[model samples]
Target: MMKKPNTAQTILSVASCKMTRAILRKTGRGGTAIPGIVAMKAAKNILAAVSEGMEIVVVTGTNGKTTSCNMIEHALTSGGHECLLNKSGANMLHGMAADLIAAADWLGKPQYPYAVLECDEAALKLVVPYIRPKVIVVTNLFSDQVDRYGGVQNVLQEIRTGVERSPESVLVLNADEPLSASLARSTPNKVVWYGLEASVGTQGNVDLADAGACPECGGEYAYDYHTYAHLGGFRCPRCGYRRKDPDVAVISVDKKGTDGSTIHLQCDGVIQKVRISLPAVYNIYNAAAAIAATKALGLPAQEAIDSLSSVQSSFGRLETFSLNGNRVQMILVKNPAGCNQAFSYVTGTGEDYSAVLCLNNRTGDGHDISWIESADYEKLCADPHLKKIYAAGDCREELYARLRKAGASEERMERVSDYHALVEQLKEEGHPVFLLPNYTSMMELRQAMTQATGNREFWE
Candidate 1:
């Protein structure tokens, strides 16, 4: 049970936060985190107070956090449960505080029965201590925001800290990810592992693996097969750490196309054919994660699988739009692995599409442009269906240089610095447009495209 605050300070804090949010919204500012910051500063225990009596699920990882959270939220809502979420992609402590405060009344009482939070990996340590979620879903870990996280080990430690704090929370982990699977050994929390079974096919050869060395013994791990980016059937020769059988496994893939996929999902010995509306192997992993999470919440596996069939791409991830009679698909790429996935998706579509690569070196997007080299840009350039490539964003020059180095033809390359101009140019292109943007650049591109198309703003 949540401890209600009877103090006048608590009341004043909640009132001030609410008022600030309202004022910001009215003034055409999307102040997503300010209210929570103000509330937390005014009353330190505000999140705890409001989060009481709600079943909270915290989703955190290097990638797929947003999509996974969206899937879980969709499942919960479709199952007739009112849920709260930080929909503005605010996953930090201040942002989370703001979200919870916004969902509560003036007295910091929650109106919803559930809160599905997309949490930043570092922010997990801060949030889990206070909210103590009923379930913590770790999608997977990879090198991301290198300037902020320093290294993948640091990220693992941060998530481990959060897990340790929430001893009672059920953990939905990825068995194929050695780092994620290792978390089960550290914390006393009950863990439910989910991953692709061997029948789904092996990951293609890549020059690098994020988790090449075993976390347990610091020895090079061997793999029976790989899905992508160091996720698959792995075994540490030195420490005997091996992949565990998943509670929710993808037993077979019936069909995989540009639109979606059909797979056989086996949960607790029961198998069912599930359709994932989103394309890509990464999304299949996301579907497995969502199914495991829903099961952890005591929801039927079929309910979650059904919700996945209708799950639309969240925010800028594989979001499609019809602009001026031309199709535009926006995919958010923050790291090499994610970028490679997008590249594969675009080229595999078998359509002649114009591609826009937006790069930004803002702090939010790690300043390390070097990771772009790891993406299979050469393969993307080799695709004959990729008609033309447009470079945009603050780091357009860098992107152009990278494209050239990747063997992209100079005749087909152009630079569009202004997002509005880029959108206009894309509108004129007769073929479909695939836009890939980094973190900050994604927000800018989405805003420009949405404003021109009259689509609802992200905050809405």
Candidate 2:
């Protein structure tokens, strides 16, 4: 049997690994890739470091993992709890180890009072056993990274396994996801479900992320209302299984893009208004999930709401910036579900808009742009507010072809292979440019923007 590493040895191993990552991070070469590989080895080296009852919380899903995790961390800290997080958007084993290493005390102990991790679905299958978190949050399951994960069900099963294995942990789920909601029904762990409800100003029509089928009986599901995606009031027709009323719900949501909101929320009937800077109804859902998780931790509803409105996007999740006298909004789009929500947010406002859509096929971006076709491109092309579409990054031709099918004029589409060139073109135009970029493309453009303008806002 392999001997567990000692504290000094473990610290040394982590230090060495982080040093290597630091060197890579400085190279202008995609060094963030190494964290995924190094995290597992670091975990092995630090096998003896973790103790029981550590209060570790892990957040995972195709979308909202980063945003949700960020909210959790913020709330936890707001309650005066020290927490450790993989803030670099790592999610894999090596990246997780790096985060732990960075947060460790001088004595090689992780000084944070609690641990919160955002785990990639496939990575969670391997890392959960090692970490054994006290809380696991599955944000939502959708057809994400099909090239890497095969299918949504496959990733769902992997997450189910992770939650099942950690029976002692609390499972926080997106009750609207058919698979995630069903897992809550069968899992041995204590389960907490969060979802939106039908109401005025909410989506009456389902967005593409809607999973509108019964996971148990393959029966059709009914919706009282539809939020951006498959989330909202839902019930399976055959099994009569329905979306449970959420313990926490955003009762009244008022958002003005680039502006903020006064969100009225109710936690099991207690109501309060939350002041938040993040715009978009999708963010309200994100906030609702965070509030639910905090309530699960036993904090008062008002406390969660107070902290939630103060939280900001960690990076490229609805982060806004001023660039070339224009308000630039960056929304990360990796899967069809997320892409659809993004498209809806931009087009629904009925404001004339121009956008720079960046795509990349790197391992981080999943090498499969085919899912872009599955997105609701018709929302963009048919919207009278949309003026121009500039496609950049890998597979621009494919993206152009797909957008064309949805009514985008061939004359309005401009393809640019370089990030710098795209930014220059964006600067020449004075309209708000909604930048939709996948993982790697976001980072590439982030670096270019940082170099040219000394601002991280363009990528944030």
Candidate 3:
């Protein structure tokens, strides 16, 4: 157990956070992580001190962490339960500490009993030891920011080290992903599994990641069916390792399209039809994870299932905006699997649309943009629904090179550095639009889109 701080220490810590946050707001820059750093410097273990008696649920993984966390938070709040979260999508230790600190009174007393934190996969070990959460959710894992973590194996190790620290915490693991599902053996922690039992009918890209190698034994395996990249029923040829029965599973994806999906789900033994407002089958994985996590937190499975229908898009993840009389949907693409899924959503229907693809190597966007080579833009190029494919950001040459290889003609693609010019063209064209940008590019472009479409809005 952590030693509680004295009254004097609490005052100093809270004061430090307040002063630092005020200065950041005044400067209009760097408000998320700095304040918590300063506060922790003043009083060590400030996250533990502020969250002394709170119930925390930490969601960590490469792709679905934010979406899964948002779904859990929505269910909690929609059911008349007040809770706090790191609204800025900051999953680092310092950002979460700042959020918890802000939620506390001057004496470092928590105002809410429930807190949901989105933690970075590598940082999960660091944050979980302090928060000692009631439940930890690991959405599917994949190679993310290879420049930072090196590979998926390294990230998997980081999460295991953290879970090892909290052996008593119940973990909600993705049953189909060997990288994530392998966590079940890392510790004595109780595990609740959730995943898609089969494909949602569109996971047919032959380029799916080679999840055939068993994480335990380095032997090749075979898949019964593929839902998406590296996810499905699997059994190792050498070792007996295989996918287990998921507690909360997507038994069948009843319907899916550009707008959204309707899936038949079996939640902790009860069968229910879940209509998720988000598009793509990846979100089906997210909804299942949310339901499992919420149930572990003592929420009724039905309430969590009911809340899935209303979970709105978080920040730049599949957010829709309106510009002059046109509707535009923005999807954040980080890796090959996620990028390919976005392509499927944009061209899933027969409706023609214009799109802008941005690539950047800014620190926030990962210094490596070579991942684009792994992403298939051929679908977008061949689709009859494509009007114009605009390439933006630092790596247009490389992006264009890949597009050319994918058969995109020079006449079919245009270059745009000025986001305002891109918006003006969209307004004139009056066709539906799709915005695909990485981390930094998304921030830069979403700023312009939000500024132009301030009043007119459409809910997806």
- Could you list the CA RMSD of all candidates, in the order they appear? 1.7, 2.9, 2.3
Q: Which of 2 and 3 is the better model by TM-score?
A: 3
Model 3 lDDT per residue over 361-453, tens place: 888777987888887788788888798889988887778778889887788799888988788788887688999999888877887887788
Clashes of 1: 2
Ranked by lDDT, the better of candidates 2 and 3 is 3
What are the Cα lDDT values of the candidates? 0.85, 0.72, 0.82
In candidate 1, position 20 carries an lDDT of: 88
Q: Which model, 1 or 3, shows the larger TM-score? A: 1
Candidate number achieving the greatest TM-score relative to the actual structure? 1
Order of candidates by TM-score, top first? 1, 3, 2
lDDT of 3: 0.82
Q: Which stretches of model 1 miss by more than 4 angstroms?
A: 1-4, 199-204
Scored by Cα lDDT, where does model 1 land?
0.85
Q: Tens-digit lDDT track for model 1 on 136-156?
A: 999988887777889888999
221 in model 2: Cα distance from truth in Å? 1.4
- The residue-level lDDT of candidate 3 at 228 comes to 80
Error of 3 at 136 (Å): 0.8
Clashing pairs in 2: 35-95, 38-94, 39-93, 39-94, 40-94, 210-230
